[model samples]
Target: MSGRTSAASPAWFAAVRPVLAFSYLSLSHLATARDSHALAALAVGMIVLLLLAEPLWHRRPWAIALAAIAGIALWQLKDSAHIHIALLLMPVIFLLLLAWLFGRTLMPGHVPVISKIVRALEGGDSEAMMAELDRYTRGLTTIWTVVFIAMALINLALALIASPGGLLARAGIDSAWSISDSQWSWFANWLNYGLVGAVFAIEFAYRKRRFPGRYKNVADFFRRMAALGPAFWRDLFK
Candidate 1:
């Protein structure tokens, strides 16, 4: 028998599989929080089973459904507090999970996928790219999703309450009375920087290098310390 896979193999597996797994996690978190096995081993086992079964069916609808169900169950089990404390850890887990199951099968590596998307955004119409970017980020985690939703609601409420003319009228009396266009723009930009910085720092520190997984060296240690210098200064001042 030929070892070659069809063109559809990758799209059906790499792209679709992770999404299905995440869907499973969401359902699990919301609906099966009571089960002890919902979070860790059980979730991993479910993913394994889905992976095994997926190839058998040539990545059919049932394969996707099974994977998604498993992912949702596991996500449902994430501890609320741990979720906040370990927000940076969540994407690594998702990336590794995707790589383990579908890395070889996928056409482009993660970095290349991102690079291409960025190029497309800079050169072409941005609407479609923005939509895909939204989907890519949405696959992040339960905590991130909740936080973003809360931010959106807060911003919407702010917009509704402070009519521009009314805000100008009260600006002389109260700091809170002013919600200018510049203020809204500044808030949006600040949020963007914070989120991007957090993700970038995590990726920079932990991603695998060209070499196989190896211990850090003295040089690497010093380099990390150098990177932290700015943060140390800011903290000392505060």
Candidate 2:
């Protein structure tokens, strides 16, 4: 019984880690709209989680100290008007980071990120299947990069247009470029997710048609994607 419990521990940790990490991320986004104190707490929580989960950070006491200091500073400065600006810019920053992740791999000498994921999923498939997977995955990577970039740009545009003291205001442009803050918030917090979900559904449909031989049903595809999460994070951080 002790041996079985010990053997199951690693598998349990592996299964729970991604769920915890994603929950933390989602909480951070939700906390941004609260107050500076909430955001600062979220920041510290993330750093603590990272240190606990990633063995490499265990030896880096200085890094942990610096992060704690930064988090404290953020908490101290929470009442500043700048904190509001940071909250407003959060969606743009997240989208841009995703864009960079996908776009950077598209450069010369780097395997497409989606292809890397697909290869992990395929494991020891036949050469013919691999060749088809490679082509399809590369195309999907390109599509994802474009989508992220577009989302980032749109988020940025909305942020600028909603800012009363931003460039558009200084330029005396009072058209659609001067949208309300609530409207921008609606897009950033709500519609943005809907857009991504819609795109994912559309892309799944396209993939089904484009790679009929390689494509499985949506449920299977998602299951494979879920299985790839652990490997995905390891590759991403490495």
Off by over 4 Å in 2: 1-59, 163-176, 213-216, 236-238
Summed over model 2, clashes come to 0
Per-prediction tally of clashes: 13, 0
Whole-model lDDT values for every prediction: 0.41, 0.67
Q: Give the TM-score of candidate 2.
A: 0.72
How well is each residue in 61-136 modelled by candidate 1, as lDDT tens digits? Answer: 6666766775565476454322221222223344444333323222343422333333333344367755654454
> Best TM-score goes to which candidate?
2
Span of ten consecutive residues with least summed lDDT in model 1: 81-90
lDDT of 1 at 124: 46
